[model samples]
Target: MQRYFVAPAQISGHTAVLEGDDARHLAQVMRARPGDKFIVCDGSGREALAKVVTVDKDIVRAEIVEERFAESEMAWRVTVAQSLPKGDKLETVIQKGTEAGAAVFLPFLSQRTVVQYDERKEAKRVERWRRIAKEAAEQSHRGVVPEVMAVSSWKSLIGRFAEYDLVLLCYEEEGRAGNGLRRVLTEFAAKQAEGGKPRILIVVGPEGGFDEREAEAAAAAGAKPIGLGKRILRTETAALYALACIAYASGELGGD
Candidate 1:
């Protein structure tokens, strides 16, 4: 089924109104008309089964036939805080991260990061990443569209560590720290077996990798360093790999 997202305000009573670019897509691109059925997601984890009742130049009215809980999101809410990578790599991160069940994306500048964003460029970057996330969510049949926040600095991201239950830092230095991702996940799983939701914050570094002092600072902030493997993965590849593993390990993805 075709899926579209709209604000909750657009869905009132039995009608779901499609406005702006969505309206144009339905009217022209999709060639939709009255009586055609489509699924409208309000980005709040709800899916409404609707059929078009009326179509106009700027708005399409859809009648809600049924409403149900959307597809399963994830047992754990993972937020990926990545140090900005070069060029189109950030776009790839946004798209794949959304598909991997990331609730939100934080693009930050680290000491070794090659990419820099000023206020003006930051606004444009956020806009671009948000669009990428939206389209990816739709393509993957995600119930909610993940958000892409404005660019931030590593120090600012570290300060927000208290908001999450567990913070995992992907680093090659985990061998020296006496802690690894497997151990961290094992402990977290033991806790979750009892009760409550798991909220994990994953921090991935840039192409040049994290500086030693920066890694220590993140550790002091309570983020455990975890090794990906012996082979070094690129900045963009690490976050997606981590999120995929997290989903599978958390039982969100079925296993034998």
Candidate 2:
């Protein structure tokens, strides 16, 4: 069935309303009619199996036949704190990361970041990223769309580490004091098994990689420096790689 996310307030009692753009898409684009069934997600993990009851120029109303619990979400939440890469690379990170079970996205600037901040364009860029995440979530059948926060600084990254149950830095310096991602994740899974609602933050560096100071600060903030593998990866690739691996480790990718 087709799925559309509706605002929580739009759903009251057994009726769901799709307004504005969504309504136009249903009425004009999809040519939806009464009695057609579609899935409606509240974007907070609850969904309704609804049958269209009314379709007008400005709105589409559906009656809920059944309510659903969102089981597609991973057992734990994963957040990607990706350093702003050049061009549209950040959008790629948000899109694929959402599909791979990321709960949130954090775009930050590190010492090695190449993209300079533009206050005038920040809101627009963030909005684009969020739209990408929402579309990706729909495509991937995710329970909720991952949120993309506005650009932040290195200090903000450090200050937010304490908010997560496990924090990892995707670094390629194999010779440095570090553990492989597999080992680190395994240990965390075993040791922190009882940690309710696990929140993990995986930070990835930009194309030039993390400067010495950024790496040092990450370690001091209690983020384990972990390697993806021997080969170097682009910043966007690393973010998706980390999230995909976490999903498997937590049994979301496959049955244990």
TM-score of 2: 0.95
The best candidate by TM-score is 2
- lDDT for position 130 in model 1: 95
Query: Which pairs, if any, clash in model 1?
Result: none
For all predicted structures, in order, the TM-scores are 0.94, 0.95
**Once model 2 is optimally superposed onto the true structure by TM-score, how far is the C-alpha of residue 7 displaced, in angstroms?**
1.2
Candidate 2 lDDT score at position 121:
97
Give the Å error, residue 172, model 2. 1.0
Report residue 104 deviation for candidate 1 (angstroms): 0.7
Query: How well is each residue in 1-256 modelled by candidate 2, as lDDT tens digits?
Result: 6788878998899999999987897789889999998888989999989999999999998999999888888777988999989999998888888888899999999888888778899999999999899888888888798888988889988999999999999988942444579898888777655545688999999999988778888899898889898778988899888887888787666775
User: Residue 14 CA error for candidate 1 (Å)?
Assistant: 0.8
- Superposing every Cα of model 1 onto the true structure, what RMSD results? 1.8
Residue 190 Cα positional deviation in candidate 1, in Å, after optimal superposition: 1.3
- In terms of lDDT, model 1 sits at 0.87
How would you encode candidate 1's per-residue C-alpha lDDT over 152-182 as one tens digit per residue? 8888999999999999889977735545567
